[model samples]
Target: MSLRISDAVVWQETGEGISLYHTETGDFRTLNETGSKIWLAVAGGGGAQPVASALSREFAGTDPALIKRIVADVHAFIGTMVDQGLFEESPA
Candidate 1:
């Protein structure tokens, strides 16, 4: 699967993090540093696995279990974004 930012959503980078606004629903979300990175990767057409792998490498020397957790977290993040209508998923 591939991910893309929703057309209805607009985002901006702030000193604290990234802010997302949903035009249709008037919903708003803020992502911290890590989440901002994941959002960028997904917005750049990355899938869950690739994003997770890149994150794992960035945190090199992390425990194996933690790496697995990161993978799970990335998947969960993507799911939540889709559910929140912040992202659109498509078959690759």
Candidate 2:
């Protein structure tokens, strides 16, 4: 599946991190540096696997187990964002 930011949400990049506002629900979220990177990847139309791969390359030389953990975390993060209505998922 591919992921995209929800139409009801708007975001801005700040000095410290990224800020997201859900226009429909008035919900607000702040993402740290790593989260912002993942958010940007998804916003650019990346699916979970591509995002995980990109992150793995960026952190190349890390332990294999840690890489697996990172991949799982990326998937979890995207899932949570979808559950919170901050992102929409569709068939790739």
Reference-based TM-score, model 2: 0.93
lDDT of 2 by residue, 10-45 (tens): 999999789999999999989999999999999898
Residue lDDT tens for model 1, 1-92: 88899999999889878899999999988999999999989878898789989997787457898888888888898899899899898888
TM-score of each: 0.92, 0.93
Q: Which candidate number would show the highest lDDT if scored against the true structure? A: 2
RMSD of each: 1.2, 1.1
Please identify model 1 stretches exceeding 4 Å from their true place.
60-62
* lDDT accuracy of residue 10 in candidate 1: 92
Q: What is the C-alpha RMSD, rounded to one decimal, of candidate 1?
A: 1.2
lDDT of each: 0.88, 0.90
